[model samples]
Target: MNFTFEVLPEERIECLRESCNKLMAFQKSVASIRPELFDTMNFETRLLPSMEKAIHNYTVVVKNNDEIIGYVYSNISPKDTYSNEFATFFDVTSVNKPYVGCLSQFYIKEGFRKYRIGSRLFSMSLDWLKEFDEIEDIFIFVSNGNSNALEFYKRKGFNISHDILDGFITVLRN
Candidate 1:
């Protein structure tokens, strides 16, 4: 099936809310396998707020006709040096170049995993980041034990740049 992607508008609060709830539900199910894979309340209490603050966000949705099967949301900023997680990553590396993009979230429904939806989301996010002119590289974190995710990123030209105890950080320099 062919999927069309687009940016979500603010007026579509219902769509966003539904998608957010679905994403959280799916993540929670996955978190059960590795309870430590997620934080207890970060998504609803923190990240969602952060995402809301960045109104110029992107939500790439994969649709099979009229239904939305999956979606990915991302927020980018050069001033995102506030979080300890970002600080920890910066300490081990250097942003010697001009541009760096961070991916806040990338999610796909389980039934649609084989459709390259994740790749499309990643590509669209990176492409959108480039519109800033200063973003030449992209960075993201994946669970340490998510070997499938690790391998997917690797196949898409991302390299393991840093490894924390719980997860590994990967980057793609442009």
Candidate 2:
């Protein structure tokens, strides 16, 4: 299957809706594997809004035959106001530090996993964050159970910063 990777079209409602659907599906998939890592709230009421907000903030999605098969939500912002499931899991505290980029949400459809789509999405996000010179580093939290993701990030040069709850917070310097 052919896959196209690009920034999400936040200006288009249709695109946003597609992204929301993909996120919900991704959430469900994760919940099955690690229920504790996902919220028990409704997708429409809780998760969708957060996904929409991140799309508006900064995000990328991969499409196969015009269907959203993968996505990576990220942002370059101050650590204080940037909140996401991963960040919140760590209960990140506000600190007097420069702005940093975050790989907040990332998902790739099951069947598409072997195609390197997630890596492509991550590389794209890193390139986008590089546009902001103030972003000196990028952070991502991977669940300890998700060994594949941890290995992938490590292969990409991200170092494990520390253990956070049930996961490890990793970082990559730009």
Candidate 3:
């Protein structure tokens, strides 16, 4: 199988929409197994919008044969008042800094797992974040139950900061 890893392009708006729907589906599937940990409704209404915003120049996707199989959405900017959900996942106030970047949403289709697609997408986003000198560190939240995700981030040098809303937010300093 051939795969391409790159920043999500503006011309591929449909890919963005499809990725969001796939992510929501993935979350809902997880919710079926651990309903208390995953909220499909909140993901659709709240997290989806944030991921959409992050798509602007900050998102990376892995495609196989021109089909998007995974993505990592991220953003960097001066800290400001954010949604309660955002605060719930990250220690926003503790940042106490001018600017920060966030790895907001990351997903790879079930069949595509263990293929290093996610790792390539994440590394691409980290490389993009490095271009911004103002960003102090990058933040990512992983479901406490998702041991695979937690281990992946840990392997990539992310440290657990604290628990939030049934998940542990991790940080990777730039």
TM-scores for every candidate against the unseen true structure: 0.72, 0.70, 0.77
Off by over 4 Å in 1: 11-14, 18-39, 52-56, 79-82, 85-87, 96-99, 168-174
lDDT tens digits, residue span 1-174, model 1? 767776776455356555556655555554425444344434465356656656356667767777777777666544444245533554323664543566766667667889878888888887787676555556766644456776877887777766554443333333
- Report the CA-based lDDT of candidate 3 relative to the real structure: 0.66
Summarize candidate 2's per-residue lDDT along 1-174 as a digit string, tens digits.
878777755454245455555555555454434444444434354334544444225677788988878778776556544455445532345333556677766778778899878878888887887777665666776644466777888888888766644433333332
Q: Which is the leading candidate under TM-score?
A: 3
Per residue, candidate 3 scores C-alpha lDDT tens digits across 127-164 of 88878777676777664446678788888998877665
Q: In terms of TM-score, which candidate is stronger, 1 or 2?
A: 1
Off by over 4 Å in 3: 31-48, 51-56, 81-87, 166-174
Predictions in order: lDDT:
0.60, 0.61, 0.66
TM-score, predicted candidate 1 vs. hidden true structure: 0.72
Clashes of each: 1, 0, 0
